[model samples]
Target chain A: MERCGLYLGCNIPLKAPDIEQSMRKVFPALGIEIVDLDGFSCCPAWGTAPSFDIDTWLVVAGRNIAIAEMKGVDLMTGCNSCFGVLSEAKHMIEEHPEKKAMVQEKLAKINKTYEGKTKVYHIAHILYKEIGLEKIRKSMKYKLDGFKIAIQPGCHILWPTKVMEVTEKNPFYPTMLKELCEALGAEAPYYSRLEYCCGMGALRSTDQEKSFLLVKEKLLSMKEEIDPDMIVTTCSSCYLQLDGAQKILKERGEIDFTIPVLYYTQLLALCMGFDAKEVASISEIPREEIIEKIQSEERAQ
Target chain B: MQVETVNLTQKDRKAVLAQMIEKGGGNLTKCIQCGACASVCPVAITGLPLYCKRLFRFLQTGHLEEILDDASSWACVACNRCTEICPRGVDPFHVVFAFRRIQAQELAIPASATTSLMNFYTTGHAVYGDASELRQKVGLDPVPPSTLKYPEALKELQTLLDESPMAELGLF
Candidate 1:
C-alpha cells in the first residue's frame, strides 16, 4: 500500500467535516495509507493570508509542507486553496533561494525545516495516477450504474499550472475529472460552462449578490444542458460553492433545479459498498435523495 | 465606447504598476487586450467590468484609478480562469489579487474577507468554531489535528505573522 501525509486544510477539518470523513473512509479501502500529519498547521488559505502578505503566506505554507517532510512522505489535501497556495509557495521557494532563506528562518523558530522536495497532491489526481482505472473500477460495489454526473474540477487544480504538480494537459477542455467519474461507472457529460468559476472564495465573501449572478449563470446553463442527476467535484471549494450556492439560488428564485452534489470520494465510497450513512453523513446539503437516486439507477440521459 | 483619457504626465507612471508586477501581476504590458481574460471571467459574464483584459490594459496605460471602483475586482473568485486562457502568459488572477491587496491595505476590504482573515490570524484557519458537536457525529476527534486542537501550533502561526506585514497591516 502506498503511503502519504493527509493535509486537511482549514475548510474540511472544521466547517465541512464530511469531506474529511469521506477522505478517511475512502482512502484505506483503496490501499492508500493516510498518515496523521500530527501537529500540522493550516494551508493559510489563499484569499485571507496569501492575498495580503506574501511573506506570511510562504512561512505558514512552508511549515505545513515541513510536517510531511519530517515524516518522510509527500503531502495530499482535499482543498484547492490549500493545494494552490502551498504549491505556489513550494514553487517560489524552489525558484528563489532568498525566499527559501526567509522561510527557513521562520521555520527555524518552530524547529522545523522544509527541504522543498515534498510534492503536494490533490486527492483526485493522485487517485487517478496511483490507483489506476482498473483498481478503482474493481473496488466499486455499484459501479455508479450509469449515473450522469456534472463535474466541477474547481479552479486551483488547473491554473498557475507551472506550480501545480498534476494539471490537465489541455486545461481549457479537461477530461481528468470526467474520466475519473467514468471509471467509477458514471456518465460525466461535458457542458459549456464546465470551465466557469463558481463564485466562491473572495467573490462570495465580498458580494453575495454579485457572486450569485455568476452562480446563476452556471445553474441555468447546467439545467439547460445535460441536466445531470447529480454534481461531483474534486476540490472542497467547488463542492461548497456549487452545492451551497445552488440551494441559495433556488431559494432566491434565481433557478429552478435541485441536483445533489457530492465529493468524488464520497461518490466512490458509496460505489465501494460503504454505508451511505457513514460516507455521506456529515454533508450540509441534502444528500438523501441523491442516495436514493444512486441506488435506483434512474437518471435523465 | 468613448475612451476616457488618463493623463500620464499628471501621475508617477511606474509606482503603481511596479508594486503590482512585484506581487505576481506578471508583465502587464505583455497583455494584448484581446479580451480573452474578459471572455472567461465569470464576473464579466454577469455584465460586470471585472475583466482581466481591461485591468491589464488600464495598468499598461497607467490608469489604475479607472478600474478601482469596478465591482468585478471584489467579485473576483481567484479561480485563475483568466490566467489559464491568457496567450501572453499574463496572469490576470494575480492582477486581481494585487488590486484586492491594495484595497486591503487601504482597509476597504469587505467584512466577510476581514472575518476570514481574522479567523486565520487567531486560529490559523479561515473557518473555526466549536464544531465538536458535528465532528462527533462524523466519528471524528471533535477537534481534528489542526491548530485548534494544538495551541502551540497556533502560537507558532501567530509568531510567524507577528514578524510579517500582517501584524502592522491589521487587515487580519
Candidate 2:
C-alpha cells in the first residue's frame, strides 16, 4: 500500500473531526496507509500568519513540511487552504534561495530543516490522480447509483494553477471532483455557479451579510439548475460554510430549500460502508436521508 | 455614499504601492486595468466597490491612504481567480494580500483578525474550536496529532513565530 503523511490542518481535526473520521475510514479501505504527521501545526492559515508577514508564513509552513520530510513522505491534506498555502510555501522556498535561507534559519531554532522536498496534495487530488478512479470504484462497498451530487471544488484547489500541485486542466470547469463522485455511481452534474466561491474564509469572517450574498446566489443557482441530492466540497471551510449557510438562510427565510453538504471524503466513507454516524453525521444540516439512500444498496466486498 | 476626493500630489501614495509591491506583490506594476481579474473576483461578484479592478486602479493612481481603512481587502477569500484570469499576469490575489499586509502594518486590521492571530500563537490553530467530544464521538483521539497534543512541538512553532517578523507586531 502507498503511504502518505496525513496533514490535518486546524479545522478537520478540531471543529469537524467527523471529516477526519471519514478520511481515516476511507483511505485505509482504498489501500492507502495513513502516516500521521505528529506535531504538525496549522497551515498557519492566510488571515493569521500570512497577512502579518510572508517570512513568518513561510517559516511556519516550512516547519509543517519539515515534519513530513523527516518521515520521507509526501503530505496529503483535506483542507484546500493547507494544500494551497503549504504548496505555495514549498514553491516559494524552492524558487528563492534567500527565502529558503530565512525559513531554514527560523526552522533551525526548532531543530527542523525543510529542504523543500515534500509535495503537498489535497485529498481530492490523491483520490483522483494517485489512487485512480478505477481502484476507488473497486474498493467501494456501496454505490451512489442515480444519486445526484452538486460539487463545490472550492477555490484554493483550482486557481493560481502555477503554484498549486494539483490543478484542473480547465479550472473554469473542474471535473476531477465530479468524476471522483461518478466512481461511486453518483451523477455529479454541473450547475451554473459551480465555480463560484462559497464565501467561506475571510469573506464570511469579515462580513456575514456580504458573504451570505455569495452563498445565497450560489445556492440559488444550484437549487434552480441541477437540484442535486447533496453538495460535496473539497475544502473544510467551504464544507462548513455551505453546510452552515443553509441553516442560516433557512432561519432568515432567504432560501426555502436545503441542500446537505459534505466534504468529498465523508461521501466516500459512506460509500465504503463506514457508519454515517461516525464519518458523516456531524453537521448543521441533517444528512440522514442521503446516508440512508447510499446504504440502501447491497454490500460489496 | 459621499465621494471623497483624492489628493493626487500626496507623496505617500507611491510609497504605499511600493511597500505593497515589496511585500510579495511583485506583479502589482503589471496591471492593465482590463478588468479581467475583476470579472471573476469574489469581491466583485459580491458587489464590493474596492474589488481587484478598482483596487488596482486606486493603487495605480497613488490613492492608497484614501483606501487604507476601507476594509475591502479583508474581505478577500484569496480565491486566486484574479490571479488566474488577469491577462497582464498581475496576480491580483498577491496584490490584495500585499494591501492586506499594508493594512496590518498600520494596525488597521479587523478585531476578529486580531483574535485569530492571538489564537494562532497560543494554540497554533487560527479557527480553533474545542472538538474533544466530537473526536471522541468519532472514535478518534480527543487531541489530534498536532501541536495541541505536543507541548514541545507547540513551543517549536511558537519559537518559529516568535523569531519571525510577527513577533515585532507584538500581537503574540
Candidate 3:
C-alpha cells in the first residue's frame, strides 16, 4: 500500500498521545504516507460495545472501518485492540451476508455502508510486511546493538487469527516483534513466558492485585533470562500496563529495579532520529536511564 | 469425600441455556467439560478461577448467581487463546462473552469498565484522559481527528449506543 489511513483508537489519543506522535514521525521518515482518518470513532473497545451488545460492537467498529473503506485505503493502527476488534468485525461482516446486511442497516441509519474491501493492518504487521525490516535497518540513524529488548506484542495482536490480515509463522511462538526489534540491531531473545498476556484490559480493571501476578512473573522471567535493559510493546494498553506496573511494583517493594517501558514506535522514532521527548516522553516510568543508554550508543557510533 | 446430590432440574438451567444459545452460546452445551480451555486460560493461570469448562458447568447447573457478585467473569480479558485452541470449536471465548453480556445486564460491572463504556457512549472514546496538551508538546493536533474533535460523528455513535439494549436497560 502506498498510503494507508491511520486509525488512532481512544487510548493513543487520550492516555498515550506519544504513540501517535511517534508514529507520525516514524512512518513518514520510513517513506510511507499516513493519511488522517477524519471523523472516526472508537473501535468501541472490547470492554465496551463488544461485551454488552453485538450489534453495537459490529456497527461501531464497522463505522470505523467504513471510514477507511470510503477513503479506499486499508486502515492501520498501532493499537492491537483496534486491530483485533475492527479486523474481526470486518471478517464477520464480510463472511456472513446476514451480518453484513444487519450492520449495513445500522450504518444506513447514519447514511453509510461497509463494503468490506478495506483491510486492517496492525503496525507490527505493517512494519514487518509492508515496510520491511531491512528498510528500517538501513533507515536507522541509531542502533540498539547492545540493548536487550523484551517485546510485548500484546494478546489481541496474535489471537483470533482468522480476522488478522497478516498471519504469524507460529502464533504460539510469535517472532514478528522480536524480528522487528532485531532488525533495529537489538537483541530480542525468546523467553518461555513471552506469549502470555500482560494482564491488562478487563482483568486489570476488575482485579488489580491478581493482574500483577502475570506482570510479576513475566518480569521475573525476563530478569532471570534476558535481563533486558528495556521493555517495548506494540500495544498501547500493554505499554501503559507494563510501564506503569513496573514502577508501582518497585515502589511497593514487591519487585526490584526499574526497566523503561516504551511503545515500539517510540523506540523506532528515536532510532530514526526523532527527539526523545517527542516520542518516548510522557512515560509513567522514567526514561532517564534508557535515554542515557541510547545517547551513549549514539556517542559510541 | 462428600457425596453431592446434583439436581439441575430444580433451577431454570434450561432457560439460562436457551438465552445463552440465542446469544451465540449454543456451543456452550457442546462443551464436553474439557479442561483444555481452563488449562490455557490466562486468567485461570493467574488464580482467578475463570476456567472456560468450569464456567460452562456453572451455567449448566444454574450457578451463575454464585459468580455474579464476584469479579471472576469481569476479569476475562477476551484473548481468545482457548477459542483458537478448543478442539470442539466451541469458541469458548464467545461463550464467555455471551455470559459477560448477561452479566453486564444483571451484575454491577467494574467502575473502570463502566466509566470507559460511558465515555465511549458519549465521546466515542473509552478514555477521556487528557493528552491534548501532550499532543501540543509533541507538535501535533490536540484532538487527533476523532469523535472528540467532531461532534456530528459522536452523535452518530451516541445514536448507536442509545438504541442498544444496554441503553434500554439504563446501564449508563
Candidate 4:
C-alpha cells in the first residue's frame, strides 16, 4: 500500500474531528494510505508577520516539515492555513539559502533540520493529482442529482497564487473540489463572490465582531444569490467560521437560514455509499437531509 | 494612559524610512496624509484605534516604536480594504506584513495568553500530547499515531539536514 503523510493542523483535530475521520476513511478507499507525523505542531497559524519572530515561526513550521521529512513522504494537509505555512516555508528553504540557514540554525537545539526534502500538498491537490477525478467518478455509488453546492475557496488556499497551482483571478481556479462534487453528480453553483475570502483568517482571533460581520455578509449573499443547498469547504477554519457563526447569527436574529456546512470529504464519503452513521460521524453537519435525499432516491430507483 | 513619547535622530528616522520604502514598494512615502486609508480601515471602523494612514505617517517620520509596540499592528486581517480604496495604490497589507516581520525579528512577542497555535508547528498535528490524551481532552475519538511508513526516506532527510552548517546551529 502506498502511504502519504497526513498533516492535520490544529483546528481539525480539536474543532473539526469529523474532517480528519472522513479523510482517513475515504483516502484509503481511493488507494492512498494516511500516515501521521509525530512531534509536529501548528504552522504557527500564518506566516511569521514582521512583528512575530521569524526564527521561531520558521523553526516551528520547519520542525513539522522535518518530521514529515523524517517519515520520507510528501506532506499532505487538510487545513489551508497549514498548507500555506508549510508550503511557504518549504518554498523559502528551496528558494533562499540564507533564510534556510537562519531557520536551520534555530532547529539545531531541537535536533531538527529542514533540508527542503519533502514536498507539501493540500488534500485537494492530492485528490486532483493522485486520485484523479476520473477515478473518483468511477468510485461514485450515488449520484447527487438535485443538490446544488457552492464552493468557497478560502484565501489561504488561493492566495500567493503560485503555491496553490491554480489561477486565482479566474472564477474556476479551485476547480478540483468542484469537479469532485460534480463527478459525484451534484450541481456546482457559480456565484459572483465565489473567490472572495471568508474573512476568517486572523480576523477571528483579533477582531471577532468584524469577523462575524464579514461572515454574515458572505453567508447572506451566498443564500440570496447562489442559493446553494449546502456550502462545502476544504479548510477547517472556514468550516468553523461559517458553521459556528451561522448559529450565532441566527441566535442574534440576524439571519433565518441554516445552510448545512460540509467538508468535501464527507460529501465524497456519502456519494461513495458510506453508512449515514459513519457519514454523520465524519460530518459536523446533521445527516438527516442527505440521508433523506439518498433514501428518497433509493425509493425512486 | 498617556501615549509614550518616541525619540529618534534625523539620520535614524531617515534610514528606517528608506528601508520601509525599499521593502514596501515606496508606497509609504506617497501618502498625502489624506486619511483615506484610515477612513476605510476595517479595524478603525471597529473602534480599535488602528489607522493605516497613521501607521504610514509613523513609518515616514521614523516613529516606528509606537507602531511596533501597539498590538493593533498585528490585528490587520490583510483584507486589502485599505489597499483597494487607497487612491495612491499603497499596499497597506504588505506594510503590515513587513512591520510584523520586523517585530518578529526583534523578539518582542506578547506573553499574555497561550494559544494552541504553538502546538501546531512543533508537531505536524495541532494538539499537544499523545493522540489518546488529546482526544480525551477535546472529547474526540483516539486516533493512532500516524507516522511515515518509509524508513529509507527518513534516513535521506536526516542526512540532507545533517550536511548543512545551519542545521548544526540548533537554534530551534
Candidate 5:
C-alpha cells in the first residue's frame, strides 16, 4: 500500500482535529497510507493574493504540492478550499507553460519548483475511486439505522463544474459520501439546497453579519425540508458555517434549532465503533447526546 | 504646498486591477449596468451597496481608494452565492477579496480584527500560538502543526512584502 500526504490545510488540524484522526483511521482501511505535509499554512484562501501577487499564491500552493511530490505520493485534502486552491493552481501551471515558467522562477528563490506531476484528490474521490463503495460497505461495523442526512456540498468542492469534476445537477455525482453513510446504515435525505454553499467564502470573511444571515437562511431552508438528524459535510469551512454560525445566530436571539454538524469521517468513525466523544470532538455541534448514546452502549456492553 | 492630484497612471492601476479581475472571476469591463448582480446580492439586500455590479464599476473606474475605504466592501460574505446566481458569473466574492488585500496593504483593517489576525500569524494558531500553552490552559491536545518553516521561502515572501506599498499596512 503506497502512502499519500494528507494536506490538512489550516482549518481542520486547528479547529477540527478529529476530522484528521477519523480520516487517518478510515483511509488506511481503504488502502491509502496517510502522511502529513508539514509546514503548509492557510492557502490564504482568497486573501493572500493581490491582483499583482497571484504568482505568490501559485508559488506557495505549488511549493506545498512540491513537498508532497517529494514524498512520492499525491496530496489528499479534506478541506474544500485547500483542494480548490491547490487543484486550480496545479491546473494553471500545467495548462499554461509560460505561467509555469514564471511561477517556477519565483519558486527558485525558495528552492521549491513545481514540476506539475502530482495530483490532488479530495477525500470523497479517494473513498469513491480508491476505496470503492463496495469495499467500504464490507468494512461497516455498525449501521446508521435510518440516520437522515443532508449532504451540504461546499461551493469550492462541487462548483464551477469546470474544476472539482463533481456533478451539480445529477444527484448521483456526490453520492459516494452519501453511499458510504448508507453502507454504514444511515439514510441520506436528498434536498434542493443539498448542493448549496454555507456562506463561508470571501463573503463570510469580509462581511460577517450578512454572512450569518445568509447562512441562517440556508440552514433554515435545510431544516424545513429534511429536518435531518445532522448535516454531514466534507468541508471544514462549511462545517463552521453550518455549525458555528448557527450557534452565533441563536445567541443573537435568532431561531433556536439545534442541528449537529458532522464531518463525514466522524460519522464513519461512529459506525466503526469509535466513542462518540472521540467522533463528536471533530463536530462543530455539541456532543452531549452523542456522547450519552455511546456511553449507554458502553454500559450495556 | 501645491496639491497635485497624484492620480495613479493607467499602467500602474491596470497592473493591479488585472489581478482583481482574474481572481474575482468577473470581467470588470463587461458589466452591462443591468444591476442584476446587485439585486440578488445578499449583502446588497442587507443594505450595503457592496453589490457585484457596483464593485465592478468601482474597479473599472480605478476608484480603488473609494472601494477600499468603503465599509460595504467588507460586507461581502464570500459565500459566492451571488456568483452562482450571477447571470454573468460575476464573482462578488473575489472582488471583495481584492478589496481586503487593499485593506491589508493600507493597514486599514478594523483595529479589533487586526489584533486577532496578528495573533494567529505570529503564534501559528488563531486563539493562541503554542499548543502546549493552549493545552495547559484548556486541557486539550497541542494544536496540530499546519504551518511549516521555509526560511528561504519566507525570506522571499518578506522581499515581496517589503516591495509592496501596502506592506506597511500588514499587521505582521
Candidate 6:
C-alpha cells in the first residue's frame, strides 16, 4: 500500500471536517494509506505568517514539512493554501540556501530540520496524477453519469507552475480537474470565469462585501455558462466560499440561485458509496437535494 | 470620488523599492506597468484601485506611505494569476506580499487579520473553531491528529515563532 502523511490544515479539520471525512473515506478505499502527520501546524496560511514576513512563513511551513520528513513519507493535504505554502517553502529551500539556513536555525531548536526531502501534494493532484483516472473509474460504486459539475481547480494549484511539483500543461486552461470529474462519470465543463478566484482568503477577511462581489460574479458566470449541478473544487477554501457564500448572496438578493459545492474528494467519496451523512452531509448550503438526486439517479440506472 | 495626486519627489522611492526587493519582491524592478497583471487580478477585477499593477507603480515611484494604510493590499487573494501572466516575470504576488509585510511592520493590519494571526500562534491553526462536535458528527475523533492533540508540539511551534522575525511584531 502506498503511504503518505496527511497534513490536515486548519480549515479541513476545524471548520469543514466533512471534507476531512470524505478524504479519510476515499483515499484508503482507493488504495493509499494515510499516515497521520501528528503535531503538524498551520500551512501558516497566506493571510497570517506570509503577510508578516517571507522567512517567517517559510519557517512555519518548514516545521510542518519537517514533521512529514520525520515520518519518512511525502506530505499530502486537501487544502490549496497548504499545498501552495508547503510547495513554495520547499521551492524556496531548494532555490535559496540562505533561506534554508534561516529556517534550519529556527527548526533545530525544535529538534527538526527540513532537508528538502519530503514532497508535498494536493489531494486532487495525487488522485489525478498518481491514482490514475482508470483506477478511479474502476473504484466507483456509483458514477455521476447524469450530473454536470463546474470545476474550480483553485488558484494555488494552477499558477506559478515553476514552483509546483505537479502541474497542468496549461494551467490557465486546466483540464485535469474536469477530466478527474469525467472519470467519476460526471460532465465537468468549461466556463469563462472558471479560472477566477472564489474570493475566500485575505480578500474575504479584509471586506466581506467586496469579497462577495467576486463570489457573486463567479457564481453568476457559473450559473449562466455551465449551469452545473454542483461546483467541484480541489481547495477547501474554495469549497467554503463556493458552498457558504451562496446563502448570503441569496439573502442579500445578489443572486437568486444556489449551487452545491463539493471538494473533489467528497464527490469521490460519494461515488465510492460512502454514506452521505458521514462524508457529504456537512455544508452551509444544503446538499441533501443533490445527495438525493445522486442516489435516486443511481437507483434508476 | 477624489483623485489623489502624488508629488514623486516628496516620496522615498529608492527606500521603498529596496525594501520591497529585500523583503521578497526581488522582481519588483522588472515590472513594466504593462497592466497584464491587472488584466487577470482579482483585486483589480473586483474594482480595488491599488491592484498589483498600480501597487507596483506606486512602490516603484516611492509612494509607500501614501498606500501603507490602504486596505487594497489586504484584499489580495494571493491567487498568483498576475505572477503567471506577467510578461516580464514580475511575480506580482510576491510584490503584493512584500507590500503586506511593510504594512504589517507598521501595525497597519486589520483586526480580523490579527485575530487569525494570533489564532495561528496559539492554536497552530489560523482559522480555528471548536470542531469537536462536528468531528464526532462526521464519525471521527473529537480532536484531529494535529497540534491541537499535542500540546508539546504546539509549544515547540510557539517557541519557533517566538524566535522568528514574527516575534518582533509582538502580536502574539
TM-score of chain A in every predicted structure:
0.95, 0.97, 0.97, 0.90, 0.90, 0.97
Query: Model 5: per-residue lDDT, tens digit, A41-64?
Result: 555454444322456567667777
Query: What lDDT would each prediction earn against the true structure?
Result: 0.79, 0.87, 0.84, 0.64, 0.64, 0.87
| Model 2 DockQ (Cα-based) | 0.77
lDDT digits (tens) for residues B1-172 of candidate 6: 9989855576777788888978888789998789999999888988888888898888888888888998899988887888888999888988899999989899999998889989988898888999999999999999999889999999998987887788898999
User: lDDT per residue, candidate 6, A196-261, as tens digits?
Assistant: 888899889888888898889899999998799998999998889988888888888888889988
Stretches off by above 4 angstroms in model 2 are A297-301, B1-13
Q: Show model 6 residue runs off by greater than 4 Å.
A: A297-301, B1-10
Interface RMSD of each: 1.8, 0.9, 1.2, 6.7, 4.8, 0.9
lDDT for each residue of candidate 4 in A137-209, tens digit (9 for 90 to 100): 8877777787889877675666554444433344235576678678777888777666555656566666678
- DockQ of all candidate complexes: 0.59, 0.77, 0.73, 0.20, 0.21, 0.77
Provide the TM-score for each candidate, comma-separated. Answer: 0.92, 0.96, 0.95, 0.76, 0.80, 0.96
The ten-residue window of minimal lDDT in model 1 chain B covers B6-15
Q: Give me the overall lDDT of model 2.
A: 0.87
Interface RMSD, prediction 4: 6.7
* Stretches of model 3 off by over 4 angstroms after superposition: A296-301, B1-10
Deviation (Å) of A253 in candidate 1? 2.7
- Residue-level lDDT of model 3, residues A1-301, one tens digit each, is 6888999998887787878889988888888899888889889788888888787888898899888888889889988878888877888788889989988899989987787888889988889999998999988877888889998888888988877889887788999999999998899988878988888888888889888998888888888888998998899988888988888899999888778898898888888878887777788789977876775655344
Clashing pairs in 3: none
Candidate with the larger TM-score of 1 and 3: 3
- Model 1 lDDT tens row, B1-172: 9999856555555887787767666567577788888877776766666566666666776766655665567667666777777898777777777776766666666667678778888777787777888777777788888887789988888888888887887664
Q: Model 1 segments beyond 4 Å from truth? A: A293-301, B1-9, B21-26, B64-71
lDDT per residue (tens digit) for residues A27-146 in model 2: 878888999999988898989888978888888899999999999999899998888889878888888999999888878877897888788888898999889999999878888888
Model 4: DockQ vs. true structure: 0.20
